[model samples]
Target: MGPKLPPARFVLKSFMAESGLEPRLLPHLRVTNAVEGKVDFELDITKDHTNRLKILHGGTIASMVDLGGSLAVASKGLFSTGVSTDLNVTYLSGGGKIGDKIQATATCDKSRCQYKTSIDYRLTGNEVGMTLAYTSVVFKNSKGELAARGSHTKYVSKAWQAQSEAFTLPEDADIAAEE
Candidate 1:
């Protein structure tokens, strides 16, 4: 068997609590798998997520693509604060219908970067998996047929606040003291 996967609900809950993303932004998404440089997510298509035609909304799919890519980058355990410099999605088939399960997997490409060749080569296979690269996310329907594909280029911030520890306020901080 493959590596044991964490509970999807727990992963999502922890990610939201740490990332501070509003629950409403990704109410139906669940993290099915998360490992260094890779992440997978799933969503059950419900009436609430459908368009007037009773099919999953394109916007919803696009949002999932973005979320998948971001989470994949976060799996590296390096930086969490980043902005998508470019996102492109191509719909390969009709959107899912209500009651359908849509699955998405995001994989970060470690070799794609503008850095010097020698340094970039060295960065490969590093424990941290840090690299300035693009993330590719693929969405599939319940039957495992391709639904959409997305490419996201993210600029991970190197600022101090982007460190993982920054997500948690110090116990002695003013906010904690006030509380």
Candidate 2:
């Protein structure tokens, strides 16, 4: 059994509140699903998120990249998702207009267990980049048309390593705090 971490949605929503940038830009973004090293979000394309062309702004897509990566890292129990060391975004379509809904899925590309035995020195050993997370995001419109895709690399070693306490779950982790 691994450590008992807070629910993924809890970590993500709390991040939306605590992150200085997220509260200002994506105050209303909804976390639809969250799991270890992954998260999904849905948001309406508001005029505020558009450019002079009335299309979803490239800046907005980039911000989503950052947000998605951070949320994914937080889902791993690193509530304080570390600084973005790199970010790359590619615009595909218009993304959406002021009334369209878009969904974004963010996922971390690597994990300790997944690479545990691959290296002579394990990531679990807290060696170099023990908590570096390379995350990717895909954005799609309500019709399931691809809008944009992005990648983010963040250095989260501090927060990840600081989480020394582990709690075994009493049961499956899907249950909630309240209705």
RMSD (Å) per prediction: 7.4, 5.5
Colliding residue pairs in candidate 1: none
For candidate 2, list the clashing residue pairs, or say none. Answer: none
Q: What TM-score does each of the candidates earn?
A: 0.71, 0.77
Per-residue alpha-carbon lDDT of candidate 1 for residues 1-179, written as tens digits (9 for 90 to 100): 11213322333455556764425556757666666567777888888778999998887887777777776665544335367778899999876899999999888766532222222323345222333447899999888899999988777645223453423322443311000
Q: Which parts of model 1 have CA positions greater than 4 angstroms off? A: 1-22, 112-122, 126-131, 159-161, 164-179
- Report residue 123 deviation for candidate 1 (angstroms): 2.3
Q: Evaluate all candidate structures by whole-model CA lDDT and list the values in order.
A: 0.62, 0.70
| Predicted candidate 2 versus true structure: per-residue lDDT over 1-179, tens digit per residue | 11223455555556655678776777777777766667888778899888998878889889989988887766655656778899999888878888988899988876553222222324452212465778899999767899899999988666545455321232544434322
Model 2: lDDT to the true structure: 0.70
Clashes of 2: 0
When summed lDDT is taken over every stretch of 10 residues in candidate 2, the lowest stretch is: 113-122
What is the lDDT, from 0 to 100, of the residue 55 in candidate 1?
91
Q: Which candidate achieves the best lDDT against the true structure?
A: 2
Off by over 4 Å in 2: 1-6, 112-129, 166-179
- In candidate 1 the C-alpha lDDT for residue 38 amounts to 76
